[model samples]
Target: MLSLDYSKLLILAVVIAIVLFWPPKNKSFHRRGIDPGFLNLKVWPARIWFLLRGRNIVEQAYLQEKDAPYLLQSLNEDSLVLPPKYLPELRMLPGGKLSASEALVTSVLGQHSGVDVVLKDRQHYDIARVQLMRSLPTLVPILSAKVDSILSETLAACSTADFTHVKIKEIVSALVLRTTLLTFVGPELCENTELQWLVEEFTNIVRDMAIFLLFIPKFLRPVLWPVLPPTARMKRLHERVRRILFPKTEKNVKSSRDFPTVIDHFVATSEIVDEKEIVAKFLVLMAGALHTTKMSTSHAIIDLCASPECVDELRNEALAENLNDLPWHLDQVSCLKKLDSFLKESQRFNPPNYLSFDRIATSTFTLQDGTAIPKGTFISMAAGPMAMDPGYYEDAQTFSATRFCKTDESAVESGAEKSQWAHEFVSTESGNIHWGHGRFTCPGRWYASAVMKVVIAQILRKYEVKFPEGQRERLPNVYLDLIVEPNPKQVVRFRARE
Candidate 1:
């Protein structure tokens, strides 16, 4: 294993060397006027250090956005960071002209796994955009039930008033994956510990490996990937995933059982249902779906804990609705306006990234501001900072748990018209691109919103969550280039409410 890892490292180093030496195409745009953040790295050591410090470099760009877009040099690519005013233009560009998936694929070595191409394909996204969105109302019942059961099991493990300290991310990750699988894959894997383990392990590998693999060139990924440790483990998990899911899919096809899950929808929609395809797609879907909800829930929990008053508001709202007796319906979850506002407020402060709507220019494209981007230039909008800008939001830097709540006080304070988007987690007005921008915003956001609400509501109803003594403030998030993840070490005290 040591020998194999060293060989993989050697190959990776060689690929990096080759890529670095190669003359990059499309380095300049004729109409470009914006200043580059860090240019002309005359020394190789500075370039290497810059790569290590890429996230800070990009944050600096966000801090220094003047009147135009700014360029930031990443490990292997140069990205142009635009303000939110350019989002409408980005949304208008066709995929052929500026492809978000392609930019992501290139940045993360997605082409090697073939996951990026699958995601980019319109047919695959249609399943998410059309079927998943359409079925969310019906599926929320199952999702809510799953959330309730998972919370019961998790809380039962910590049934004490002495405050069982737990990492919110770990708990959220486990719960979100189980609930999502229950809705997407089926009960078979959701209940099976081995299958759940497989999903968790595979996703963890993808998340860790994708970042490291991004530094390696695409041409060499296939060559070096198999030699890496995670690659072998991922392949083993893939086969096991196939073994478990394929049989069920075939059985469903043979028996013609009508199930309310994504698998059933895929099987019904496809002319020739392929088990491998279905399994692969399901894994990919979980990778995207699970972490997003987990992070969102974790951040929201942190915010609620910081301001215990929000938790009181949510718990009261849930109690008024008789949450425990009522079935967790879409409308019921939607009615948790304070909870909705809390989630949205948390997202505004802690988004996936400072950037959103990432795209690679396919051809020379000019913005409304008359700046031209050359073909092959990577681009994105400053979504996170823009959302937190005081110009767009009053007291933007402060975390207001009930900022979006439709209470008379909040409405009067924030202005009824301005805080309208804060009522729904899916609402994306006032430069809030947590769901991205335009026609290609997250297709499953409605479903995602409902699932998160149910999980959070359950916690609020039964558990009193707070940070350890003197740790009321949230731990700062770890920023890695374009990614912002919740602090893994942050702990929360959970106890059954009296």
Candidate 2:
């Protein structure tokens, strides 16, 4: 009976896949056209090819069609790949027309997975944009202190006269989550080990659910969600998170603290004060903040370990600035030009994702060049390829640690201020879209940058890090469809600096 039921479901799924994967009979490509490769095949085969070689496919298309818009069929949807030239116009389009949030919802199957906070309410993001940015001046010092304390404890616990192997991702993830939670909840609540475990588990659960649901047809999600193991785990985790966070959120809503947190701001500003709503918002914010920052920091450390020659250079810069002797000021952090450039270079080589400026057209629109974008068409820029394109950066294939800072050298010689010479890691320029571009560019970038700088600088000042013996290069990055991640098991040897 069970086998028979499974067979029926499998047959039903294939039928749905066949219908969904059927190519449009009258595919239109306004002025600029669909990639020739995609035009010749049924959309399913093209999507399969994409899953196999999406990065290379994107790079090839970008190199081949540098000037014009082209269409590429991806799993789940077709995206109109636009050149950077269209960025200015696209940025100006109102959210109702070109909706990044809606694009995210489609990308993640958010409606089925309960990750639609952006579409349901913009208040959390607005609070992050305004209050979070407003609080950074005060927040930086607090974060710096927290980072220093955490690193000191980490190093002490792992101390050995000789080098000791430590998983870099584990260290970085713990540090990123703790600091993120400190900023979100408060110092006291951030220290709850159970709460921390739940948040991490919850992030993993949601990510797995999203991936599982991605292959399921949209119409079938409602039917299948109840029996999905991840869904059950998600429900239990959500309840656990609410139980842990509700009392604190309820308390915060009534009275503000001296040092305002992201939760406090969300409660104080948002009209919706329901405990479940606040907890959901917190989970969304924590997941975003924890994942990207953790990956970037881990990659930066691995990059540093691989480029041993640059280690002393960065260490000297950190020591020269007395970064460890005092709480970090934003301006002081900015002045670490060499470190900043190295970080930017690392990220250029290992971005969080291959695409950026992702949006879905809510209504049909025409480009200045007469290319038409039909309503419901998904769109993205080939950000990963563009970052390495020779047209954008000279010797783009090589990792030049000082590529961004070399201009600063001339500025310094001309007596320009350090601020003038400093290149920010959070730049969303066309040439560097590691952070998504436009009005919807990452809101917490400034905070992420500050935290990363502090954590890396502390490591350089207090410890020596290198890849395990015989590992001469950084571990190759793991790629999942469009997303990129530093290898979670990558290990580095660490010893306290004498």
Candidate 3:
């Protein structure tokens, strides 16, 4: 008997989330070695080891030892990882000459053979981001409509009430999927289930393949990359994408098409590259925006459900600002200051991976404290440590939604220097806590911020979420083989509020 009850599923999910998050018993899993070869082979084992030890890789090794503001270490460029303090020096060759961003991407995808953006430096990332971000302020209505449709469709198949819980993941997944499809394939194709399913599957295949592919020998990688099943699916997704792309092949592509999506801009301005190359960009665009954005937002929703104080403030802000009935304007997105505060607090407490940015020296460079890092080196900030470090943020590991708020309040009270806390929150120009300081940071940051705001607002306005009775806040343990990612999955419930 296939007894399917979503509430039960949510209960099981909460259990799973707890298990995934429960600190492991090993501490060395979080420690670093200088070789990518060592990481690729033993990432899982290391994660398990570190989980048992209760120390992240960095915490177990360098971070614990360094009492000075910063210190010199013998770790070299190709080390699979580097300690936190050396990150800035590792960002560029001395004098801001050569960047280390290239090394990070190359390490992830295994080959720069295809991503032209990698070869072009920050220019390509910036242009693509500008095009995408410039289009967001206009997408408010389109995104709202898509969200409603996803909710209606998702709830249509569900049954939840006061005594029941709903596996919020499916509902949220539906929301993310529909919104992404609208942007990627345009509304006409987006509403098509067949196409949307294909796109979602294609995304899943690429990510899973990436995880598995990293284990293959470097020599075998180049030879095997093309033979992977995900590569074949990518070709098909691309072929379909090209069919959708050709109409705007610059003949009459408008700067702002009715939808103004990545596909609209790509075929409109740039010379046509290889079909695979174009597909790769589109795939990356979808994956980049949806995966991280959805995961973070979903977790936030769960956190809010767990903390009614946070949710009540968010709901009041959204309703007070006329968010419910109005189209999602940029102002509406911005008015949720408390919501933003809550989001930042969540990130502070549970960063994607106990680390954020990646850097590798192109040449030898010295730290602010006079430590020399050899050229072509790798390093990442201790995300868990940095965000948790009281030196930078008070009560570093605690969730203080009003922590930055206090900064703003103090500025207002002084009536001298106005608080730019929110501005700093939104501004990538100043770059904080390793969101890839400066230009090489994720180009899609603005788009990401917008989506997060919309989703949070939507949830706050419509649902009352809460953790199961007696459950506690869960902070994930991230294991970075390449980059930081949230631990596997979490389960939580959402019920429509009257």
Candidate 4:
């Protein structure tokens, strides 16, 4: 009976796949005035094969195009690949017309929870942008102290004289998540180990579930999602968070004093705040925050470990800042040019994703050069390939820790500030779309930058880090679909800096 049921479901899935991707007879690529490479029978199968072979389509686009648009297969439909030239016009379009959030929903089978908070709830994002991101300089003192304290506790288990093997992902994830919650949720939940662990578990549950579901088509998600392991874990985690956070949220809702976190700001702005829903929203925020920052921090550590000279240079720069007397804000963080450059170099070689500036056309729209896009078509800008392009940077393939920080003699003669390159970490200038482009860029990136630097600085100041026994080379990151992650099991040895 079980075998029979499995056979039936397999047949149903095959049928759905055929029906969903069935080529239309009348409206072919040529008839629609689009590139035929997208629909070519040979290309179609090869692109599908690329999915299994770990070949990324964005790299394909960057290598082929000069300044023209191309075609690629998206999760749900055919995507139009645009060059950087189209960014200004496409970014200027209203979200209702060219919607990235809707594209994300389609990409992830509508499983990206709290996407609405990011797209529809302007109030929530505005408060975050103004109160958290832009206010980073002011919040740095409080955030830095929390970060320093957490580092001590997290690394205390390790002995100082001998190298203690530690999984960089687990250690950095805990540190980033805790400090983020500290700054975003306040001391109550941040200090609570159980609550912090719950957030981390929830993040893992949702991330694993989302990545798994990204492979499932939109039509089949409802039927298949319930059976996935992460689904059950996500539900239990959500309930646990709700039970823990409800009373705290209630107290804040009724409180008179203004709090420093984004949650306090959100509660103040919202008209009828449901505690359960708010908890879920916070989960979304943390999930989004934890994964990207954690991975970036891990990658930076990996790079630093691989090159001890880079570590010494960054540490020397950090020590020269005399950060104790300064306010330890954006301006203060900005002075650590080598640290900033090292992080950017790591990001350049291993970005968070292969694609960026993804959007779905809500209505039939034409590009500046008159290429028409159907209402339902998806589009994305190449991020990873653009960063790796030799046209953009000298020796693009090699890792240079001060690639961005190093200034030429011409700059000195021209009176350009050497510190200008620090913005590369967060800004989207010269086709650097990691943070994204225009108004749709990650609003919380400034805060994320500050948090990352603080944690890295604290680690450098207190402890020494290096790759574990016989593992001199940094572990290669894995690319699944569009997500990039550092090696989870790769251990780093840490000891107290003498």
Candidate 5:
């Protein structure tokens, strides 16, 4: 085994050397537009710069290029950074022409990461877009109750007089994961600590492996995959996940439970009957919903803590709506306009990703402006930069908790012709592309928004939370490549309200 490992390492080193020294082929399509300065560097070095300062590169490119598309080279792939102006035309293209799933697979090295299920079968996406969404009215109250219960039990040690320290990310992650699992699986299995451990472990291993593999050229992944340590661990965890989920999936298919779940919907709607296939579908769903919601919720909490005035306003809004009451309806929740605006602003400042509307061209296509998107080219919008663009928003860099709510309030007071839901957190307008845009916009966004609102409302009503002493501002987000996440290590103090 030792000898085999040594030989694998030697081969890896040779591959690395070749990748570093090789001159990358310049795409003719990239020649059509201005090259982001970093793209002029050698392949490995360019990717290194991107990995280190991707956000800056993207923001600078967006500022320089403005309405035109520009080329950006990253660790794993090269993407055309399309401006928000092109969203109207690009969103209308059929999936066969511009494939989001293909882009997702490429971004994550899904084939080798054991999540090729996203590429192979889109049953999970369909369930999310249709069944899961259609069932939100029924799911919201259940999730709200679950969130309240989890927070109550988790924060039981806190008192009205003194604050108890907690890692906000961990607390929010546990809450989101358990509640998400409750909707994906059943209540009993959702609480299974062993299964929870396996799922979280599998996700972390896959994420770490994906990021590491992204640094390697695409062609070399297959060659080096077998010897990668995380790959082996992922396989073991996958097998354990299958063992735990297979029986549950089979039982779910055969019986009807009181509260139907995402698994139930999968079993009913999908032609896939194989237990392993079902497990893969479930894993994909969990991966999509769990981390994004957790991070968004955590960021909102951090943002709330940083702005005490907003907390009081949001708490007042929640109280006015009686948010603590059980069996809250969607209509009732929607009335918390101030809370919704605060969440939207929080997301605008700290989106889950710096880029959005990522797609890969299936066939060569030219835009109306004569810019050609060659086949296999990856594309994305500079969503983070767009949020801060002063053209779209006034005082864009400053965070106003009522930024979006003011529009709604004005519309009501003036009786204007604006849609009430225009600026809500889940809105996917070109200006607000965090949830994505057009037909393929996130189907589960409404669910995610409701979950966030419920969690925040509960925290606002039941507890007083703030940054630890001497920390006055929100912690800076931790950026990894294009991914942006709330600082996981940031601590907050929570005390039960009198």
Candidate 6:
């Protein structure tokens, strides 16, 4: 066993070295319109490689907006329009080139979903996202039950009595997938061993595939995909996922249950019908939703554990405001202003990915200072820069539980719209190239946030959490494509609210 383990470790090291030192084709790295910067992607290893070389890509055209001199030379024309103060200039989209999600989704998951890419276009995209958003409010009944069961199971799963030195990610993943899968695949199959294996494994596989896709050229992805042989794995996972989703679905009509799940809900509202395809698209959404939610939840908990003073503020607020009875509701959760701010701050500094969300210009555009960007240019806002820059955030680097306290209050007091933390953190009314801009923004954000904030609140309310004896340092951050994840796994212990 030791020999085998050593062999595996040696193999992994060799792979890492090759991937790192392998002569990267500058064409692959600089491939125009493929993906912005390698760092902006969700692929691991490669994204890590990008982060290791973060200095090179820090303000490169692919990841961040460059200054006026070198900006215009990078590519196409037409996107020259003054960016709104609140909006970062997306790379060279001429003033009016409207980018749609259609081509993009199909590029990512449409084929995987086996659904027609046309439906992914702007009109259908907006309709589907809004429908999902509408269905979001309906998830309370589901999420509330989910929160209680998962939290209890988590506390029970602790390693010790006084406190369990637990790796925050594993526990977070266990709870997050459980809650999210309950909604996406429904209750019966949610807990089934077959289904759980599929969802969990499918998530892992998809994450790996995302890295593979980043390096492979866009046009060649279709050809390269089949060779990777992930489909065999997908077949098993999709089969189980379909069985859990509903019978009317094209591939899974054999099951007789007529009840609705998020999968069924999507099928009912759209022209979509192929169950396998639905599973594929839904899987993509799950990765986006689950990974970030799990990571952020982990961050928030660890942040609470790491900062005793912040924890006390949260404890007092929870007691002063008694959040237990009102567990699942958004309004109830909204009352803990500092908790809300802390979550915001944690995400701001400890954003799930080191690189921010990115956008490829369909046409062309310009920045506030008249920096022209060409069409086909991939542009990402300086999210990490913007979020942590003292210029953008006061006391920028330290995770202040109250950094956004004033911003939150200002919005409410001034009768300003309650923008999302992603919106507020990125400092925009417009959607981010990362989370999405305007119409393309992530709809599941509210649901993801609901899960995150509640998890943090519950932990703070119920346990005195801290790092296990000697390990107080928050784990270093990792980057996959553009997403931020914790430094692998770090443990924490929880004791009764003493």
Best by TM-score: 5
Best by lDDT: 5
lDDT of 4 by residue, 166-207 (tens): 888778877787778876777776777888888877756655
Writing each residue's lDDT as its tens digit, candidate 2 over 164-238 gives 788887788779999998898888778899889988887777778877876666578899987888988978888
Better of 5 and 6 by TM-score: 5
Any residue pairs clashing in model 5, and if so which?
none
Candidate 6 — what's its lDDT? 0.57
TM-score of 1: 0.83
Task: Give per-residue CA lDDT, model 1, range 1-498, as digits (tens).
Answer: 999999999998987666566444344431122222223322344345554765565556566653457665554455677766666667767777887667766666665553564653565567778898887777777777777777777767676648888888778977888888777767665787888888777667766677567555556777887777767776778889888776544354323223467877777787877777777777777777877888888888888888886677788998876545565777777788878888888998889876777788889877776777888878877777777776666677788877666445433224223445557888776457778767658877887898888888878887888899888588989876557788889999888776
| Candidate 5 Cα RMSD after full superposition onto the native fold (Å) | 6.4
TM-score per prediction, in order, is 0.83, 0.86, 0.75, 0.81, 0.88, 0.72
lDDT of 3 at 367: 61
lDDT of 3 by residue, 1-498 (tens): 235687789889987766555543222223343222322333444434444442344555545653322211111123334454454544443425445445545545524223334444343465457777777877766787667666656656333565244565666677887787677657666667766666666556656666666566667877888888767766676677666655445654343347666666665655655555556666655665676776677667767855676667778888987644666787677766777767766666655555456555567655677655566555545556665655555455556665555554331222222345453334321114535554456676677767777777876777666766666764463544424444445455556766
Off by over 4 Å in 1: 1-52, 157-161, 207-231, 248-259, 406-422
Mind sharing the TM-score for model 5?
0.88
Error of 3 at 3 (Å): 72
Ranking by lDDT: 5, 2, 1, 4, 3, 6
**Candidate number that wins on lDDT, 2 or 3:** 2
Candidate 2 local Cα displacement, residue 364, angstroms: 1.8
Please list the C-alpha lDDT of all candidates, in the order they appear.
0.71, 0.78, 0.57, 0.70, 0.79, 0.57
lDDT, model 2, position 110 = 70
TM-score of 4: 0.81
The per-prediction tally of clashing pairs is 0, 0, 25, 0, 0, 25
Stretches of candidate 3 exceeding 4 Å from the true structure: 1-55, 66-101, 112-117, 120-124, 157-164, 202-204, 207-216, 224-233, 244-257, 363-370, 408-419, 423-434, 469-472, 475-489
TM-score of 2: 0.86
